[model samples]
Target: EDKVVQSPLSLVVHEGDTVTLNCSYEVTNFRSLLWYKQEKKAPTFLFMLTSSGIEKKSGRLSSILDKKELFSILNITATQTGDSAVYLCGAGGTSYGKLTFGQGTILTVHP
Candidate 1:
């Protein structure tokens, strides 16, 4: 069975603040770590990290996986009010394309 856990279930921040979200997991056969952002609709894929140490990044979001520690971290810099949403972390197991997701972390960014 694969399980994922995310810390700081919720957060409140102001615009331009930087935040770091944590995720740890345990899986039968780990394949990859995935990050997603959800507002009202379906979760939008943010990043997929398979290799340790290498970071995947977008304009204001970045993530990295540490395979040995079975953990991953998502960093959001200069957050905007529009960035407020639920952040999700998922663990990919040997079952291709199937992911086990953790309880989402709700982020509230104020202007």
Candidate 2:
């Protein structure tokens, strides 16, 4: 059974505090790992790490993949209240964009 698990299902951080979100998985044939931020209806893509691109960074957010370890991590630096959102991790297989997701980590940034 393919599955993804994230730690500290919920977190509270003060402004400017750095936070790290962890995602671990077990799958049949892992093709890639995807990170998303969920604020409303659906999650929005943040990073997609494959064998070719194992690390991705954008602004205050960054993520890395470990194919051998079968897990990934998301790091947020200089957090802000606006950064409060649910973080989701998904595993992508060879079937196009087909992904199995984790329950999600709810992050709250307090000002």
Candidate 3:
């Protein structure tokens, strides 16, 4: 069965602390790995890493993909209270945007 798993299911960090969220997966016909931030409602997109674009970065957030390892990592540098949210990782395959999501990593940034 295709699945994704994230480590450190929850985290608490002081302002300016750096944190890394881990996601590992097992799937067939893998196409891409996507990252999202969830606060309420549905998750919002953060990064999408494919064979052509294996690394993505935005501000203090960055993610890298390792197809061989079948996993990805999200790094947040200098986190702020505003950064507190649930981090979600998903795999995109031939299912046409159908995503297999990991149990999100909840992040709480204390000021």
Candidate 4:
């Protein structure tokens, strides 16, 4: 059975504060690690990390994978209230694309 864990289950920050989310996994036949952001209903895909030490970034969001450590980190800079959401990381493999998701880190950005 594959399992994923996320640190600091919840966070509260003011606008413009930076945040870092951590995810670690232990699974069989690991293929990829994916990051997503959920605001209201659906979780929006953020990044898919397959290679170690490679950082994926888009605007204020960026993530990196450490395959050797079986962990990943997500960073959000210059955060705004809109950045408040549940951040998720999923461990994916050949099991018909099924992913084991983390508990999720709830971020609250207040102005």
Candidate 5:
């Protein structure tokens, strides 16, 4: 069975603050680590990491996976109120469409 856990179930930050979200997992035949952000509607894709150490980025958001450690971290720098959302982490296995997800971390950014 695959299992994912995210730390600090919720966070409160002000604009311009930097935040790091943690995710740890134990997955059988792990293929990749996936990150998502959910606001008012459906969740939006953030990053998918297959290789360890290398970081992926988009604007102020970035993420890195550590395969050996079986963990990943999502970073948001200079956060804005618009950045407030529920961050979700998932572990992807060899099977497509099969993922074990963590109970998201809710980030509330204040102006």
Candidate 6:
């Protein structure tokens, strides 16, 4: 069956720490993998991975995809309390942007 899995469901860290979050998936007809940050109500888009081996970075956050392994990783550096949020990864299949998401990785950054 096609499904998505995320590791380290939750983490707690002091400010300025670096963390790595993982997402793996298996889909019958894969298209892309997307990452999101959910701080309050709506989730904000982070990265969209369609090709493997290319890393996407924005500010202190970065992500990479491995199509062969069917997995992806999100890394955050110099974390801050404002960075505390739920990191979500969703896999898009051949079905028109339809995505199946992993549970989420909750990161707590304490000052």
Each model's lDDT comes to 0.93, 0.89, 0.91, 0.95, 0.96, 0.95
TM for every model, in the order presented, reads: 0.97, 0.94, 0.95, 0.97, 0.98, 0.97
What local lDDT score does residue 19 receive in model 4, on the 0 to 100 scale?
92
Segments of candidate 6 deviating more than 4 angstroms: none
From the highest lDDT down, the ranking of the candidates is 5, 6, 4, 1, 3, 2
Encode model 4's per-residue lDDT on 1-111: one tens digit a residue.
Answer: 899999879999999999999999997999999999999999999999999999999999999999899999999999999999999999988788889999999999999
lDDT score of residue 74 within candidate 1: 97
RMSD, candidate 4, Å: 0.7
> Who is ahead in TM-score, 1 or 4?
4
Cα lDDT of model 3 by residue, 62-95, tens digit: 9999888888999999999989999999997888
* TM-score (C-alpha) between model 1 and the true structure: 0.97
Residue-wise C-alpha lDDT for candidate 6, range 1-111, written one tens digit per residue: 779999999999999999999999998789999999999889999999999999999999999999999999999999999999999999988987889999999999999
Clashes of each: 0, 0, 0, 0, 0, 0
Which model is ahead, 1 or 3, in terms of lDDT? 1
Instruction: Estimate the overall C-alpha local distance difference test score of candidate 2.
Output: 0.89
lDDT for model 6, on a 0 to 1 scale?
0.95
Identify the runs in model 3 with alpha carbons over 4 angstroms from their true place: none
